[model samples]
Target: MLLIDLDRFKPVNDLYGHAAGNAVLCAVADHLEDLLPVNGIAARLGGDEFALLVPFTGGIENLKRLAQQVITSLVAPISWNGGAVKVGATIGIALIAAESDADTVLHAADLAMYQGKREGRGTYRVFEDSMDTELRERAALEAELREAIEHGAIEPFYQPVVSLPQRDCVGLEVLARWRHPTRGLLGPDQFIPIAEETGMIADLSYHLLRQACLDARSWPSHLLLAINIAPQQFQDRDLAQRILAILAETGLSPRRLEVEITETALVQDLEAARTTLTSLQNLGVRIALDDFGTGYSSLYHLRELKFDKLKIDRSYVDTITMSEERAKLVDAIIKLGSSLGLVTTAEGIETDASVAWLSGQGCNFGQGYLFGKPMPKGEVMRMLQAGPRLEQIGISSMPESRIHAVPMEAIIHCGVGRAA
Candidate 1:
């Protein structure tokens, strides 16, 4: 039995669309067929994965040759939807011995395929017992995540969002942190996918929203709070109603809350997403497109949805120092957002150089490790009260600290009092 795993397939499907994705899959199947013996069977197991069963009464050399052929065949570019798409495959080989059952052989092949994925892909690996240990560890982590959420072990961390031009603390982004009683503070990488797969993201989303609102209510009235909304949360029929109720119960103004959704969410079911978003917008809440340029359909969705804000993904920002292409892309996205009358926020700003470049390029806002990592509500409040500072030496200077110099009478007249 042999299994082939395609690497980085999600980005291709995401950037080029599923029709292109299907073309790649079909090409892979054809390649496998050409290599397999007449009795061999090739099947697409779905989503960039494929399986082949060959009557392997043959030597190791023959199996290696077949793997090489399959890889070489897949190297050719595929044309779909007027675009050229390229992809590579990783092959895993497992022999069906005289004593082996079909299931056992398939299992071995599957493990070997994953081994190829782990070993940098575009290569082949034989099955080994070690892969079983890694699988079990992942399973255990997933189970623990379920228990952690049930026991209210997840906590919120706040990241400060500073205003551009003035550089004042304008808002906070609520980030989820899992604090396993036994495992200490676990990052989202440990449990987020588990939450998504198990359909627990909706509950988690509501929990985070409520917690963030409640915390924001305790802060100075001028500060706003933002929370990420998973696509699954939108699938809930009563999501808009639930958010409205939460805002009313918390006595928080809807204007102070921003819910971020990715471009993928907008594309999944455009009409339904539009209705849901319109309802939220009607309630005075702001909607921001998260990871703007990362999605293939970003421009299409931007024209259709008319979101209030466009958040540039970190992938583009992270590469600005290394690649001019990324820098130009960021520049174009900022201009695009501006032309659409949308506020643009660049995420993952990690250095003085990047911040200077983005600020010069007319980017409206930025978020990254350079400003602050996500913290608890109290820490964020303290940071906000401390005001914004310009840490970069000799690049562009920050605007004067007029944010803190606003008179107490003006604040009172604005009807926003200091936090208790």
Candidate 2:
């Protein structure tokens, strides 16, 4: 049995409407029908996933070759509604070995498919016994995530965003934390992708939104709160209405809440994403292009989406001081955001040099451990009550003024005494 997953399916579904998504599905099914033998069965397993039951009479290499053929065939874009959509599939094969039942075969093939996804998709994997443990652990994590939501085990942690020009905390980004009761605090990387894969992201998103809105309501009125959105949640027709309702219930102004979405998430279906973004914008919520510069389509999206803010990805921020290329990229991004009249925030500002560099480049805002790490809501509340620590300084006051402000004599005297 061979199972194929359209790895890039979500973008197609998100960019086009479900109707166009259905068309792509039908097209894929038609292709499979044409390629499979008379006894083979091809079935839709819903939402960009398909299953193919092929008789186990062939060698594994033959199945791999077939998968490659399917991938190559799909390289051509599918025409739908006056536009073309491009996508690819990853296939997993499990030969019906002796003593293998349907469940075991399916499980093995599913693991193989995931292996393909890990290797960058558009490929295939044959079942191996070693994958069984990892698959089971993932299944367990998925189950645990569902329970975590029910038991209120997932909590919101706030990471502060500092205004570089003012050196004062202006807002907080609400990040999800999974407290496993026994496993201590777990980051989103541990279970979020599984949540998205299993279609639990919508529920988790709403839960976080409600919690974040409630927390922000208690904070001082001037401070803003930003929350991340999974692309899957955008599929809901009433997402804008739901967000507005949450704001109303929490007594928080829509303007105080910012929604951060990845560039990859928005480029999947430009038209549908535009419609959703327009709806959210009408609700008075600010939208930011989170993790910018990581995707191939960031520049194209910036022009198309007209986002309120641009968040520079950490990969560039981390090495900005060491690499002239990275520094130039940051400078260009800051200039781009300024020209577009959008606020730009750099993430992963861990050192004073990096912070100074960003400020010198005219970047307006930043978030990173150098400012404050992600902490629980109660801790965030306490910190907010403590008020802003450093005063905000302008771009002209950076590097030179900062250096002049420090006592150079003290450093010289300390070095002299140590050398003696």
- TM-score (C-alpha, index-matched) for candidate 1: 0.78
In the predicted model 1, the residue pairs found to clash are 158-375
Q: Tell me the tens digit of each residue's lDDT in model 2 across 57-142.
A: 56777777778887776656888999888778998988787898989888889999988897789888888888888878878888
Q: Quick one: best lDDT, which candidate? A: 2
261-309: candidate 1 lDDT, tens digit per residue: 8765665556667888899899877888888877656778877886888
Checking candidate 2 for backbone clashes, the offending pairs are 15-269, 165-393, 166-392, 167-392
Q: Please report, in order, the local distance difference test score of every candidate based on alpha carbons.
A: 0.70, 0.73
Model 2, runs deviating above 4 Å: 1-6, 9-96, 101-106, 118-126, 390-420
Give the per-residue Cα lDDT of candidate 1 at 390: 28
Q: By how many angstroms RMSD does model 1 differ from the true structure?
A: 6.7
Model 1 lDDT on a 0 to 1 scale: 0.70
RMSD of each candidate relative to the true structure:
6.7, 9.5
